[model samples]
Target: MTTTPGAADWRAANLANWDERVPIHTAGSFYDLPAFVAGRNTLRDFELSEVGDVAGKTLLHLQCHIGLDTLSWSRRGATVTGLDFSAVAVKAANGLAAQVDATTARFVTADVYDAVQALGGQRFDIVYTGFGALCWLGDIARWARTAAALVAEGGFLYLAEYHPVADLLGDDGATVENDYFHRDPIVVDAPGTYADASAPMAATVTVEWRHGIGDVVSALTAAGLRIEFLHEHDHSHFRLPAGKGIPQVYSLRAAKTA
Candidate 1:
């Protein structure tokens, strides 16, 4: 089935796919839950540097799968709350927080679109997201609005994401395969999760959208956030072919000056 962008069924398909992957992810070596619970921080070095000194800050993490990053921020002294649509993931996150004794960490199960209301209109000092997150959203502008609304005055939104350019590259990493400008949903009906590709998965159909750097920047600005910086990097968590010098990942920091 060809899933179109903004289709309710597509969202449901994505959610089902994600929900089924929770257990697989938690068990797989990709996430390394054991190391994480043993105090290993999964956050990237650049994220740590860019976000800087989260101590005594309130942070809201959207689409935070299983709360690893959320708890990692909490360990850095931020009062952190993670939100995900997958209830199973949320439960696992809460469990992980308990195991780590992250007293300031909490997890909520809700779609990103309903984050503001789900959190009772509470704004945070830092709104954090990304790491393969933007592709899941059908509407980037709406996402920006939601993220902006959840940011308190003087706070900022930090996004660390896989570059959309990587999507354009084929398996060989040199050939142009996908369209970067494609705004519709890219449906992938396949087996296995990213964490464990060999592991069998029931919900195989998933939908994704592509949002270019320009799209993301414009959305945030239109939502009233000032772009602080847009940094592209060569390294990625995934195996992006080397020597190509293509941007594998990108980070953006947008602030609410008022």
Candidate 2:
């Protein structure tokens, strides 16, 4: 069951909702700061291997919550800039960077739609985003254009996201809980977040869109980016329901045309 709303309204509501979730996610165990300090690569192997070498490349991370993965890229020798809608997330990200002694990375607090204008024509060798990112936006085409606009002529854009199919399933284990093909916003009135299941949360609402694989590919293609690759897997970063098992790799990557 999806509640449809106008694109603008949906986007505005989502931005505000994510703003509140930023701190909860940063302090959550799923992001395990102690493990990260011990040199564990929080990113999956598929993403790491497919993204290849970033040595000396300029990388921009979109919706970079708390900057953990963005700092990880910087540690691999990329000059990195992270952008997110939440001011608190950017502050925490900057603080984490200082703590990690990562001088090559910077964090900017801005909505993705406005970042290009704020950046003053700055572009990057790689524009990257990760799981659970795309749902926040109401317009996939606009998001794709934003991504393409940020990539330099010879550079590329990369994304590794959860499969849309997995999103349609219900916890009841026998039905489709949501509309998979709906192009409108689905309102979720819930407590707590996906990051910290135990934390109590205020009763808040959020709007999300379920973009199918074709929609994703078409949006990027319409934005003039050639699809490099699209891989699917059985697993996701967090656990799904019964019969859903972890894959050896649960990531996908697609690069822009050269």
Candidate 3:
């Protein structure tokens, strides 16, 4: 039987689910930790271009899993800090940093909503997030406020994520199967981690929320960030079905003018 959780109980369920998957993801081929430690960069090409030169700048990565992308920024000459809700993931990230000799990189364990306080009110020249992150967050407005608070003045927040439209498509990747503007909590009871589906897992129940493009832009605007650009792409980190393809990914850059 599938386990169902209440809307208010997403945090605990997700924490358990992610914590259980940490070891699996670490050892799986999907992340390819060996290749990563051998000088692979996990960041997407477009993300590198949009975020631009991070050299000599402070960059904070929210929901940074395992710190591959976080350490990739460090290799590019940025002073980097990564924060995640999963303690196991944070520990793995720290270990990866050591392996890569990323002396400038640090990892912290904290919920994204508590980022400001957990990081001791530290702000960064760039606040970066995305690649399946928005879906895990329940409130875009609250998230935007927190992200904006962490961005130093004249700095920016860059987000590169799977498009909400892809969530509406069925497995076939062409048929519309789910609501695009869904506001309720989505409870998913599945068998294994995305990295290793065959891997046994005890915590299968996870709660997710979908926020539209308008919702994200509006929230950031309300939080005092000026939208610089929003770009949509047909390519995605994960493969979609071979049939008709819609926009699979999107990126947005917002600057803290104040």
Candidate 4:
């Protein structure tokens, strides 16, 4: 089914998909809530070095799946708010926060595009959303606008995402069988997630929009954010490489100068 560009169907369907995943994710070992409760920080070493000191900064994580990263920021002294479109995910995020005794962290339910407005124009010291975030968004321009709006002056956006190049490659990581760029959405009907290929899921279908790396940078720059640094890495936090090292992920740090 082709989703109309302006229609809410795509958003609603994606929301339902994520809501269904919350339970499976909670029961699975993917998020590692127990490890978090045991004082493990989910923040990757790369992000820690890039996002910089979150201490005393207001951090906002948009499209926050279950809030592990958000609570981690709170653990490091940043007052954090995690936002997602799925009510189930938001609830689970809250539960995770409480489990970790992160009293300062908060979670809210909202689409990524609507996040800034939902927060009542509240911008943050550090606006972060990446790592599988770009594909879910059909309009990179609009997404960039919301991201820029959420950045407090002098503050920036820390985006660590799976590289678009990997999106075109198959699981084997050797064949390029898909389009490298797409202006329309791709519908996927699948029973499992990247975390667990065998886990039973209620949300078996999802839609994604592909954006090239250049598209991402252009959108952000057009939205008035300066690209501080963009780095490509051979290691991916979520991927077990199918073969030799290739650029699997990229992280960008951008700040608003306008």
Candidate 4, residue 186: the lDDT equals 80
Runs in model 4 deviating more than 4 A are: 1-6
Q: What are the per-residue Cα lDDT tens digits for candidate 4 across 1-258? A: 344455477776687788888888888788776787899887778889988888999999988999888888898999999999888999999988887788889999888889878999998989998588878888899999999999999899999998878777777777887877566888787887877778777767688888888998999999999999999887753654634467788899999764
Clashes (candidate 4): 0
Q: Which pairs of residues have clashing backbones in candidate 1? A: none
lDDT of 2 by residue, 86-158 (tens): 8878998898888888899999988888879867879999999987888888788999999999999878888
Q: RMSDs, each prediction? A: 1.4, 2.7, 1.9, 1.8
**Better candidate number, 3 or 4, judged by TM-score:** 3
Per-residue CA lDDT of model 1 for 88-116, tens digit only, reads: 99999999999999999889999999998
Runs in model 3 deviating more than 4 A are 1-8, 237-244
Model 1 lDDT vs. the true structure?
Answer: 0.91
Q: What TM-score does candidate 3 get on C-alpha atoms?
A: 0.95
Candidate 1 TM-score versus the reference:
0.97
lDDT of 4: 0.84
Winner of 1 and 4 under lDDT: 1
Q: Using lDDT, give the best candidate's number.
A: 1
Provide the global lDDT of candidate 2 against the true structure. 0.78
On a 0 to 1 TM-score scale, where does candidate 2 land against the true structure? 0.89
Kindly list the per-residue Cα lDDT of model 3 for residues 1-258, writing each as its tens digit: 233455457899999999998899999899999999999988888999999999999999999988889999999999999999999999999999999999999999999999999999999999999698888888899999999999999999999998888878877687888888777778888888778888899999888888999999999999999999999888753648423457888999999985
Residue 89 displacement (Å), model 1: 0.5
